[model samples]
Target chain A: MNDKVRNSLFYVGGTAVGFVSGFFGGGGGMLCVPLLQFGGLDAKRAHASALLVILPICIISAAIYIKNGYFDVTAVLCACIGVVLGGIVGATALDKLNGTAVSIIFALLMIAIGIKSVIA
Target chain B: MTPQHVIIIVSALGGVIGGMGMGGGTLLIPLLTLAAGLEQHLAQAINLIAFVPMSVVALVIHKNNGYVSIAKSAPIVGCAAIGAVCGSFLARYAGGYELRASFGAFLIALGLIQMYKAISAVVKKKKASKNKSAQIKVG
Candidate 1:
Protein backbone atom coordinates (compact mmCIF):
# COMPACT_ATOMS: atom_id res chain seq x y z
CA MET A 1 0.00 0.00 0.00
CA ASN A 2 1.04 3.57 -0.61
CA ASP A 3 1.94 5.78 2.32
CA LYS A 4 -1.26 7.76 2.16
CA VAL A 5 -3.47 4.74 1.82
CA ARG A 6 -1.67 2.90 4.61
CA ASN A 7 -1.87 5.88 6.91
CA SER A 8 -5.59 6.22 6.40
CA LEU A 9 -6.07 2.54 6.91
CA PHE A 10 -4.11 2.72 10.13
CA TYR A 11 -6.20 5.60 11.37
CA VAL A 12 -9.51 3.88 10.68
CA GLY A 13 -8.39 0.49 11.86
CA GLY A 14 -6.86 2.00 14.97
CA THR A 15 -10.12 3.62 15.88
CA ALA A 16 -11.97 0.35 15.65
CA VAL A 17 -9.27 -1.42 17.63
CA GLY A 18 -9.35 1.21 20.33
CA PHE A 19 -13.09 1.00 20.57
CA VAL A 20 -12.94 -2.76 20.98
CA SER A 21 -10.15 -2.48 23.51
CA GLY A 22 -11.86 0.25 25.46
CA PHE A 23 -15.41 -1.02 25.39
CA PHE A 24 -14.39 -4.54 26.22
CA GLY A 25 -11.56 -3.33 28.45
CA GLY A 26 -9.32 -5.80 26.61
CA GLY A 27 -8.67 -7.75 23.38
CA GLY A 28 -7.41 -4.79 21.39
CA GLY A 29 -4.17 -6.54 20.58
CA MET A 30 -5.91 -9.27 18.65
CA LEU A 31 -7.23 -6.73 16.19
CA CYS A 32 -3.94 -4.93 16.22
CA VAL A 33 -1.89 -7.97 15.26
CA PRO A 34 -3.53 -8.33 11.86
CA LEU A 35 -3.58 -4.58 11.36
CA LEU A 36 0.15 -4.42 11.96
CA GLN A 37 0.69 -7.32 9.61
CA PHE A 38 -1.21 -5.40 6.99
CA GLY A 39 1.17 -2.55 7.65
CA GLY A 40 4.07 -4.88 6.74
CA LEU A 41 5.31 -6.22 10.03
CA ASP A 42 5.95 -9.95 10.35
CA ALA A 43 3.94 -12.01 12.80
CA LYS A 44 6.32 -11.56 15.72
CA ARG A 45 6.77 -7.88 15.06
CA ALA A 46 3.06 -7.45 14.53
CA HIS A 47 2.33 -9.01 17.88
CA ALA A 48 4.94 -6.91 19.62
CA SER A 49 3.86 -3.76 17.87
CA ALA A 50 0.28 -4.51 18.75
CA LEU A 51 1.35 -4.25 22.36
CA LEU A 52 2.64 -0.77 21.68
CA VAL A 53 -0.85 0.23 20.60
CA ILE A 54 -2.60 -1.70 23.36
CA LEU A 55 -0.39 -0.34 26.15
CA PRO A 56 -1.38 3.28 25.81
CA ILE A 57 -4.99 2.49 25.03
CA CYS A 58 -5.19 0.30 28.09
CA ILE A 59 -3.70 3.09 30.18
CA ILE A 60 -6.25 5.54 28.88
CA SER A 61 -9.12 3.09 29.32
CA ALA A 62 -7.99 2.17 32.83
CA ALA A 63 -7.86 5.83 33.82
CA ILE A 64 -11.39 6.37 32.57
CA TYR A 65 -12.57 3.36 34.56
CA ILE A 66 -10.93 4.79 37.68
CA LYS A 67 -12.46 8.19 37.12
CA ASN A 68 -15.82 6.51 36.71
CA GLY A 69 -15.41 5.06 40.21
CA TYR A 70 -13.86 1.71 39.63
CA PHE A 71 -10.77 1.45 41.74
CA ASP A 72 -9.36 -1.57 43.50
CA VAL A 73 -5.85 -1.15 44.80
CA THR A 74 -5.50 -4.63 46.21
CA ALA A 75 -6.66 -6.35 43.06
CA VAL A 76 -4.44 -4.21 40.90
CA LEU A 77 -1.41 -4.85 43.06
CA CYS A 78 -1.84 -8.61 43.21
CA ALA A 79 -2.54 -8.89 39.53
CA CYS A 80 0.37 -6.69 38.59
CA ILE A 81 2.86 -8.65 40.60
CA GLY A 82 1.68 -11.91 39.16
CA VAL A 83 1.54 -10.60 35.62
CA VAL A 84 5.01 -9.15 35.72
CA LEU A 85 6.59 -12.32 37.01
CA GLY A 86 4.68 -14.46 34.57
CA GLY A 87 5.53 -12.10 31.74
CA ILE A 88 9.21 -12.51 32.41
CA VAL A 89 8.87 -16.24 32.38
CA GLY A 90 6.85 -16.38 29.23
CA ALA A 91 9.00 -13.95 27.36
CA THR A 92 12.05 -15.92 28.37
CA ALA A 93 10.53 -19.10 27.05
CA LEU A 94 8.92 -17.62 23.98
CA ASP A 95 10.80 -19.67 21.42
CA LYS A 96 10.61 -23.04 23.12
CA LEU A 97 6.99 -24.13 23.10
CA ASN A 98 4.77 -25.54 20.39
CA GLY A 99 2.87 -22.38 19.61
CA THR A 100 0.06 -24.18 17.83
CA ALA A 101 -0.67 -26.39 20.78
CA VAL A 102 -0.70 -23.49 23.19
CA SER A 103 -3.04 -21.46 21.01
CA ILE A 104 -5.37 -24.41 20.55
CA ILE A 105 -5.67 -24.85 24.28
CA PHE A 106 -6.23 -21.15 24.80
CA ALA A 107 -8.90 -21.09 22.14
CA LEU A 108 -10.76 -24.00 23.72
CA LEU A 109 -10.75 -22.41 27.14
CA MET A 110 -11.82 -19.11 25.68
CA ILE A 111 -14.70 -20.75 23.83
CA ALA A 112 -15.86 -22.61 26.93
CA ILE A 113 -15.83 -19.56 29.16
CA GLY A 114 -17.32 -17.47 26.39
CA ILE A 115 -20.34 -19.79 26.30
CA LYS A 116 -20.68 -19.58 30.07
CA SER A 117 -20.29 -15.83 29.98
CA VAL A 118 -23.11 -15.49 27.50
CA ILE A 119 -25.32 -17.85 29.48
CA ALA A 120 -24.54 -16.68 32.98
CA MET B 1 -6.89 -21.01 47.89
CA THR B 2 -8.22 -17.55 48.58
CA PRO B 3 -9.60 -15.18 45.97
CA GLN B 4 -6.46 -13.07 46.09
CA HIS B 5 -4.35 -16.13 45.40
CA VAL B 6 -6.64 -17.14 42.61
CA ILE B 7 -6.39 -13.66 41.24
CA ILE B 8 -2.61 -13.87 41.28
CA ILE B 9 -2.49 -17.29 39.70
CA VAL B 10 -4.84 -16.43 36.89
CA SER B 11 -3.16 -13.11 36.34
CA ALA B 12 0.12 -14.94 36.05
CA LEU B 13 -1.34 -17.33 33.54
CA GLY B 14 -2.78 -14.46 31.58
CA GLY B 15 0.50 -12.59 31.76
CA VAL B 16 2.43 -15.53 30.45
CA ILE B 17 0.15 -15.62 27.43
CA GLY B 18 0.25 -11.86 27.07
CA GLY B 19 4.00 -11.97 27.26
CA MET B 20 3.94 -14.45 24.41
CA GLY B 21 2.17 -11.74 22.37
CA MET B 22 -1.48 -12.76 22.58
CA GLY B 23 -3.76 -10.39 24.46
CA GLY B 24 -4.04 -11.74 27.98
CA GLY B 25 -7.01 -9.60 28.92
CA THR B 26 -9.23 -11.92 26.94
CA LEU B 27 -8.40 -14.69 29.36
CA LEU B 28 -7.90 -12.57 32.45
CA ILE B 29 -11.25 -10.80 32.41
CA PRO B 30 -13.34 -13.97 32.20
CA LEU B 31 -11.14 -15.77 34.69
CA LEU B 32 -11.48 -12.92 37.16
CA THR B 33 -15.25 -12.93 36.87
CA LEU B 34 -15.49 -16.68 37.15
CA ALA B 35 -12.82 -17.50 39.69
CA ALA B 36 -12.68 -14.41 41.83
CA GLY B 37 -16.36 -13.57 41.48
CA LEU B 38 -15.68 -10.04 40.34
CA GLU B 39 -18.29 -8.11 38.46
CA GLN B 40 -17.52 -7.73 34.75
CA HIS B 41 -16.78 -4.01 34.73
CA LEU B 42 -14.54 -4.24 37.73
CA ALA B 43 -12.75 -7.22 36.27
CA GLN B 44 -12.29 -5.41 32.99
CA ALA B 45 -10.84 -2.43 34.79
CA ILE B 46 -8.48 -4.63 36.73
CA ASN B 47 -7.37 -6.30 33.51
CA LEU B 48 -6.76 -2.91 31.98
CA ILE B 49 -4.77 -1.73 34.95
CA ALA B 50 -2.78 -4.87 35.38
CA PHE B 51 -1.91 -4.82 31.69
CA VAL B 52 -0.06 -1.51 31.87
CA PRO B 53 2.99 -2.52 33.85
CA MET B 54 3.33 -5.86 32.18
CA SER B 55 2.99 -4.27 28.77
CA VAL B 56 5.76 -1.85 29.53
CA VAL B 57 8.06 -4.67 30.49
CA ALA B 58 7.04 -6.78 27.53
CA LEU B 59 7.56 -3.88 25.15
CA VAL B 60 11.09 -3.48 26.33
CA ILE B 61 11.75 -7.16 25.78
CA HIS B 62 10.22 -7.06 22.33
CA LYS B 63 12.14 -3.97 21.39
CA ASN B 64 15.34 -5.55 22.59
CA ASN B 65 14.54 -8.64 20.60
CA GLY B 66 14.07 -6.46 17.52
CA TYR B 67 10.37 -7.24 17.25
CA VAL B 68 9.03 -3.69 17.57
CA SER B 69 8.36 -1.38 14.65
CA ILE B 70 7.51 2.12 15.76
CA ALA B 71 6.81 3.47 12.27
CA LYS B 72 3.91 1.10 11.76
CA SER B 73 2.45 1.73 15.21
CA ALA B 74 2.67 5.52 15.63
CA PRO B 75 0.11 6.52 13.04
CA ILE B 76 -2.58 4.58 14.80
CA VAL B 77 -2.22 6.01 18.29
CA GLY B 78 -4.12 9.27 17.95
CA CYS B 79 -7.18 7.81 16.30
CA ALA B 80 -7.13 4.93 18.72
CA ALA B 81 -7.09 7.31 21.64
CA ILE B 82 -10.18 9.05 20.38
CA GLY B 83 -11.83 5.71 19.83
CA ALA B 84 -10.83 4.55 23.27
CA VAL B 85 -12.42 7.59 24.89
CA CYS B 86 -15.64 7.07 23.01
CA GLY B 87 -15.75 3.36 23.78
CA SER B 88 -15.01 3.84 27.46
CA PHE B 89 -17.81 6.31 27.84
CA LEU B 90 -20.14 3.92 26.06
CA ALA B 91 -19.15 1.11 28.36
CA ARG B 92 -19.70 3.25 31.42
CA TYR B 93 -23.26 3.82 30.31
CA ALA B 94 -24.06 0.34 29.01
CA GLY B 95 -23.83 -1.42 32.38
CA GLY B 96 -22.03 -4.70 33.01
CA TYR B 97 -24.67 -7.17 31.94
CA GLU B 98 -24.98 -5.97 28.38
CA LEU B 99 -21.25 -5.47 28.04
CA ARG B 100 -20.54 -8.90 29.45
CA ALA B 101 -22.88 -10.55 27.01
CA SER B 102 -21.36 -8.69 24.08
CA PHE B 103 -17.89 -9.51 25.25
CA GLY B 104 -18.87 -13.17 25.40
CA ALA B 105 -20.05 -13.00 21.83
CA PHE B 106 -16.82 -11.35 20.79
CA LEU B 107 -14.77 -13.99 22.55
CA ILE B 108 -16.66 -16.77 20.89
CA ALA B 109 -15.97 -15.32 17.49
CA LEU B 110 -12.31 -14.69 18.11
CA GLY B 111 -11.76 -18.07 19.72
CA LEU B 112 -13.30 -19.86 16.78
CA ILE B 113 -11.12 -17.98 14.33
CA GLN B 114 -7.96 -18.49 16.32
CA MET B 115 -8.69 -22.14 16.78
CA TYR B 116 -9.09 -22.54 13.04
CA LYS B 117 -5.80 -20.81 12.36
CA ALA B 118 -3.90 -22.84 14.90
CA ILE B 119 -5.38 -26.09 13.71
CA SER B 120 -4.57 -25.28 10.11
CA ALA B 121 -1.03 -24.37 11.06
CA VAL B 122 -0.64 -27.74 12.78
CA VAL B 123 -2.00 -29.56 9.79
CA LYS B 124 0.30 -27.73 7.43
CA LYS B 125 3.32 -28.49 9.56
CA LYS B 126 2.42 -32.16 9.63
CA LYS B 127 2.00 -32.16 5.87
CA ALA B 128 5.36 -30.51 5.40
CA SER B 129 7.05 -33.13 7.57
CA LYS B 130 5.28 -35.92 5.79
CA ASN B 131 6.43 -34.53 2.45
CA LYS B 132 10.00 -34.37 3.74
CA SER B 133 9.90 -38.01 4.85
CA ALA B 134 8.45 -39.11 1.54
CA GLN B 135 11.23 -37.30 -0.29
CA ILE B 136 13.80 -39.06 1.93
CA LYS B 137 12.27 -42.44 1.17
CA VAL B 138 12.25 -41.70 -2.56
CA GLY B 139 15.90 -40.60 -2.53
Candidate 2:
Protein backbone atom coordinates (compact mmCIF):
# COMPACT_ATOMS: atom_id res chain seq x y z
CA MET A 1 0.00 0.00 0.00
CA ASN A 2 1.08 3.56 -0.61
CA ASP A 3 1.97 5.77 2.31
CA LYS A 4 -1.26 7.70 2.06
CA VAL A 5 -3.38 4.57 1.96
CA ARG A 6 -1.47 2.93 4.74
CA ASN A 7 -1.61 5.96 6.98
CA SER A 8 -5.30 6.40 6.38
CA LEU A 9 -5.97 2.78 7.09
CA PHE A 10 -3.87 2.87 10.20
CA TYR A 11 -5.87 5.74 11.61
CA VAL A 12 -9.13 4.15 10.72
CA GLY A 13 -8.04 0.78 11.99
CA GLY A 14 -6.46 2.38 15.02
CA THR A 15 -9.66 4.11 16.01
CA ALA A 16 -11.67 0.94 15.80
CA VAL A 17 -9.04 -0.91 17.76
CA GLY A 18 -9.02 1.78 20.42
CA PHE A 19 -12.74 1.46 20.93
CA VAL A 20 -12.59 -2.33 21.32
CA SER A 21 -9.70 -2.26 23.75
CA GLY A 22 -11.63 0.22 25.84
CA PHE A 23 -14.72 -1.94 26.03
CA PHE A 24 -13.05 -5.32 26.36
CA GLY A 25 -10.30 -5.98 28.83
CA GLY A 26 -8.45 -7.86 26.13
CA GLY A 27 -6.36 -6.01 23.57
CA GLY A 28 -7.60 -5.46 20.00
CA GLY A 29 -4.53 -6.91 18.25
CA MET A 30 -6.31 -10.17 17.57
CA LEU A 31 -8.24 -8.34 14.88
CA CYS A 32 -5.58 -5.82 14.00
CA VAL A 33 -2.97 -8.38 13.00
CA PRO A 34 -5.24 -10.05 10.50
CA LEU A 35 -6.51 -6.80 9.06
CA LEU A 36 -3.02 -5.45 8.67
CA GLN A 37 -1.95 -8.59 6.93
CA PHE A 38 -4.86 -8.18 4.57
CA GLY A 39 -3.61 -4.68 3.92
CA GLY A 40 -0.35 -6.28 2.71
CA LEU A 41 1.86 -6.21 5.78
CA ASP A 42 3.91 -9.24 6.75
CA ALA A 43 3.06 -11.01 9.99
CA LYS A 44 6.10 -9.80 11.89
CA ARG A 45 5.78 -6.22 10.72
CA ALA A 46 2.12 -6.33 11.49
CA HIS A 47 2.83 -7.54 14.99
CA ALA A 48 5.24 -4.67 15.61
CA SER A 49 2.80 -2.16 14.20
CA ALA A 50 -0.04 -3.52 16.24
CA LEU A 51 1.98 -3.10 19.40
CA LEU A 52 2.81 0.45 18.40
CA VAL A 53 -0.84 1.26 17.88
CA ILE A 54 -2.01 -0.54 21.02
CA LEU A 55 0.37 1.34 23.25
CA PRO A 56 -1.83 4.40 23.17
CA ILE A 57 -5.06 2.46 23.25
CA CYS A 58 -3.98 0.57 26.33
CA ILE A 59 -3.14 3.83 28.01
CA ILE A 60 -6.56 5.25 27.18
CA SER A 61 -8.40 2.18 28.41
CA ALA A 62 -6.36 2.13 31.58
CA ALA A 63 -7.24 5.74 32.15
CA ILE A 64 -10.93 5.18 31.60
CA TYR A 65 -10.98 2.16 33.86
CA ILE A 66 -9.17 4.07 36.53
CA LYS A 67 -11.53 7.01 36.31
CA ASN A 68 -14.54 4.72 36.53
CA GLY A 69 -13.30 3.03 39.67
CA TYR A 70 -12.58 -0.29 38.01
CA PHE A 71 -8.92 -0.26 38.79
CA ASP A 72 -7.49 -1.38 42.07
CA VAL A 73 -4.40 0.79 42.37
CA THR A 74 -2.45 -1.71 44.38
CA ALA A 75 -3.24 -4.45 41.92
CA VAL A 76 -2.59 -2.24 38.95
CA LEU A 77 0.73 -1.23 40.35
CA CYS A 78 1.71 -4.78 41.12
CA ALA A 79 0.65 -5.91 37.68
CA CYS A 80 2.53 -3.07 36.07
CA ILE A 81 5.62 -4.05 37.96
CA GLY A 82 5.33 -7.58 36.75
CA VAL A 83 4.51 -6.53 33.20
CA VAL A 84 7.54 -4.28 33.02
CA LEU A 85 9.86 -6.92 34.39
CA GLY A 86 8.37 -9.61 32.23
CA GLY A 87 8.65 -7.44 29.14
CA ILE A 88 12.34 -7.11 29.79
CA VAL A 89 12.78 -10.80 30.31
CA GLY A 90 10.71 -11.72 27.28
CA ALA A 91 12.59 -9.28 25.10
CA THR A 92 15.84 -10.81 26.17
CA ALA A 93 14.57 -14.27 25.40
CA LEU A 94 13.47 -13.17 21.97
CA ASP A 95 16.97 -11.98 21.21
CA LYS A 96 18.32 -15.53 21.34
CA LEU A 97 15.34 -17.48 20.02
CA ASN A 98 14.39 -18.27 16.43
CA GLY A 99 11.34 -16.32 15.34
CA THR A 100 9.56 -19.23 13.67
CA ALA A 101 10.01 -21.50 16.66
CA VAL A 102 8.83 -18.85 19.07
CA SER A 103 5.81 -18.14 16.93
CA ILE A 104 4.98 -21.83 16.71
CA ILE A 105 5.19 -22.14 20.47
CA PHE A 106 3.03 -19.10 20.89
CA ALA A 107 0.61 -20.51 18.38
CA LEU A 108 0.43 -23.69 20.39
CA LEU A 109 -0.36 -21.69 23.48
CA MET A 110 -3.09 -19.79 21.64
CA ILE A 111 -4.53 -23.11 20.56
CA ALA A 112 -4.70 -24.14 24.17
CA ILE A 113 -6.43 -20.92 25.10
CA GLY A 114 -8.83 -21.42 22.23
CA ILE A 115 -9.59 -24.94 23.35
CA LYS A 116 -10.04 -23.94 26.94
CA SER A 117 -12.38 -21.16 25.95
CA VAL A 118 -14.45 -23.58 23.96
CA ILE A 119 -14.47 -26.23 26.65
CA ALA A 120 -15.40 -23.81 29.37
CA MET B 1 -11.03 5.60 1.46
CA THR B 2 -10.94 8.60 3.72
CA PRO B 3 -9.02 8.37 6.97
CA GLN B 4 -11.56 10.43 8.85
CA HIS B 5 -14.43 8.25 7.77
CA VAL B 6 -12.60 5.08 8.67
CA ILE B 7 -11.50 6.46 12.00
CA ILE B 8 -14.98 7.59 12.97
CA ILE B 9 -16.64 4.34 12.06
CA VAL B 10 -14.15 2.04 13.73
CA SER B 11 -13.60 4.12 16.86
CA ALA B 12 -17.32 4.45 17.37
CA LEU B 13 -17.86 0.74 16.99
CA GLY B 14 -15.01 0.00 19.34
CA GLY B 15 -16.25 2.45 21.99
CA VAL B 16 -19.80 1.16 22.04
CA ILE B 17 -18.74 -2.49 22.17
CA GLY B 18 -16.07 -1.79 24.73
CA GLY B 19 -18.47 0.19 26.90
CA MET B 20 -20.92 -2.69 26.75
CA GLY B 21 -18.25 -4.99 28.21
CA MET B 22 -17.72 -7.11 25.12
CA GLY B 23 -14.20 -8.24 24.40
CA GLY B 24 -12.86 -5.66 21.94
CA GLY B 25 -9.98 -7.77 20.68
CA THR B 26 -12.36 -10.59 19.93
CA LEU B 27 -14.48 -8.47 17.64
CA LEU B 28 -11.81 -6.20 16.15
CA ILE B 29 -9.34 -8.92 15.21
CA PRO B 30 -11.96 -10.93 13.38
CA LEU B 31 -13.21 -7.92 11.51
CA LEU B 32 -9.71 -6.86 10.59
CA THR B 33 -8.62 -10.28 9.44
CA LEU B 34 -11.73 -11.92 8.05
CA ALA B 35 -13.53 -8.87 6.81
CA ALA B 36 -10.59 -6.72 5.83
CA GLY B 37 -8.27 -9.56 4.76
CA LEU B 38 -5.22 -8.73 6.78
CA GLU B 39 -2.63 -11.31 7.74
CA GLN B 40 -2.94 -12.80 11.23
CA HIS B 41 0.14 -11.17 12.74
CA LEU B 42 -0.75 -7.81 11.25
CA ALA B 43 -4.19 -8.13 12.71
CA GLN B 44 -2.72 -8.81 16.12
CA ALA B 45 -0.32 -5.89 15.80
CA ILE B 46 -3.05 -3.49 14.74
CA ASN B 47 -5.28 -4.73 17.49
CA LEU B 48 -2.56 -4.03 20.04
CA ILE B 49 -1.82 -0.61 18.63
CA ALA B 50 -5.45 0.41 18.85
CA PHE B 51 -5.73 -1.10 22.29
CA VAL B 52 -3.21 1.29 23.83
CA PRO B 53 -5.48 4.30 23.52
CA MET B 54 -8.68 2.43 24.12
CA SER B 55 -7.24 0.79 27.20
CA VAL B 56 -6.27 4.15 28.66
CA VAL B 57 -9.80 5.35 28.19
CA ALA B 58 -11.24 2.16 29.59
CA LEU B 59 -8.92 2.15 32.55
CA VAL B 60 -10.38 5.44 33.58
CA ILE B 61 -13.94 4.23 33.22
CA HIS B 62 -13.27 0.95 35.01
CA LYS B 63 -11.41 2.71 37.76
CA ASN B 64 -14.34 4.96 38.45
CA ASN B 65 -16.85 2.11 38.34
CA GLY B 66 -14.69 -0.06 40.60
CA TYR B 67 -14.46 -2.93 38.12
CA VAL B 68 -10.72 -2.97 38.37
CA SER B 69 -9.62 -5.16 41.20
CA ILE B 70 -6.00 -4.22 41.42
CA ALA B 71 -5.33 -7.16 43.68
CA LYS B 72 -6.61 -9.80 41.27
CA SER B 73 -6.11 -8.06 37.95
CA ALA B 74 -2.58 -6.99 38.72
CA PRO B 75 -1.07 -10.41 38.38
CA ILE B 76 -3.05 -11.33 35.30
CA VAL B 77 -2.37 -8.09 33.51
CA GLY B 78 1.28 -8.10 34.51
CA CYS B 79 1.86 -11.61 33.32
CA ALA B 80 -0.10 -11.10 30.15
CA ALA B 81 1.74 -7.89 29.31
CA ILE B 82 5.02 -9.68 29.68
CA GLY B 83 3.64 -12.59 27.75
CA ALA B 84 2.54 -10.22 25.05
CA VAL B 85 6.06 -8.98 24.57
CA CYS B 86 7.31 -12.53 24.46
CA GLY B 87 4.57 -13.47 22.07
CA SER B 88 5.29 -10.53 19.81
CA PHE B 89 8.97 -11.26 19.58
CA LEU B 90 8.31 -14.91 18.89
CA ALA B 91 6.17 -13.95 15.93
CA ARG B 92 9.00 -12.04 14.34
CA TYR B 93 10.70 -15.19 13.05
CA ALA B 94 7.73 -17.50 12.83
CA GLY B 95 6.49 -18.73 9.46
CA GLY B 96 3.20 -17.46 8.08
CA TYR B 97 1.59 -20.86 7.85
CA GLU B 98 2.29 -21.76 11.47
CA LEU B 99 0.99 -18.42 12.71
CA ARG B 100 -2.21 -18.47 10.74
CA ALA B 101 -3.07 -22.03 11.59
CA SER B 102 -2.43 -21.47 15.28
CA PHE B 103 -4.38 -18.23 15.35
CA GLY B 104 -7.36 -19.80 13.66
CA ALA B 105 -7.35 -22.67 16.14
CA PHE B 106 -7.07 -20.25 19.03
CA LEU B 107 -10.06 -18.26 17.87
CA ILE B 108 -12.21 -21.33 17.64
CA ALA B 109 -11.18 -22.34 21.14
CA LEU B 110 -11.86 -18.88 22.55
CA GLY B 111 -15.27 -18.84 20.93
CA LEU B 112 -16.14 -22.18 22.47
CA ILE B 113 -15.08 -21.12 25.92
CA GLN B 114 -17.23 -18.04 25.70
CA MET B 115 -20.17 -20.14 24.61
CA TYR B 116 -19.70 -22.47 27.55
CA LYS B 117 -19.46 -19.61 30.01
CA ALA B 118 -22.68 -18.14 28.71
CA ILE B 119 -24.45 -21.45 28.98
CA SER B 120 -23.15 -22.15 32.48
CA ALA B 121 -24.18 -18.78 33.77
CA VAL B 122 -27.72 -19.35 32.60
CA VAL B 123 -27.79 -22.80 34.11
CA LYS B 124 -26.40 -21.61 37.42
CA LYS B 125 -28.95 -18.88 37.63
CA LYS B 126 -31.77 -21.29 36.96
CA LYS B 127 -30.55 -23.75 39.53
CA ALA B 128 -30.22 -21.07 42.19
CA SER B 129 -33.78 -19.89 41.61
CA LYS B 130 -35.14 -23.40 41.70
CA ASN B 131 -33.40 -24.08 45.00
CA LYS B 132 -34.67 -20.81 46.45
CA SER B 133 -38.30 -21.57 45.54
CA ALA B 134 -38.06 -25.05 46.93
CA GLN B 135 -36.83 -23.72 50.27
CA ILE B 136 -39.62 -21.16 50.36
CA LYS B 137 -42.30 -23.78 49.74
CA VAL B 138 -40.89 -26.03 52.45
CA GLY B 139 -40.88 -23.16 54.91
Q: What is the TM-score of chain A alone in each candidate?
A: 0.86, 0.70
Those runs of model 1 whose alpha carbons end farther than 4 Å from true positions after fitting are A1-7
lDDT, candidate 1, at B131: 100
The lDDT leader among the candidates is 1
Summing lDDT over every window of 10 consecutive residues in candidate 2 chain A, give the lowest-scoring window. Answer: A75-84
Write model 2 residue lDDT over B1-139, tens digit each, in one string: 5433343344344344433333434444444444444444454455444444445654565456554434322222333344334344445456544554554565666555555555676679899999999999999
List the candidates' TM-scores in order: 0.92, 0.47
TM-score of 1: 0.92
Please give the distance, in angstroms, between residue B97's alpha carbon in candidate 1 and its true position after superposition. 1.8
lDDT by residue (A1-120, candidate 2, tens digit) is 688886566455545554444444344556555555665666555544444445544554444444433433332332333333333344445567664454444434344545543343
Lowest lDDT block of 10, candidate 1 chain A: A85-94
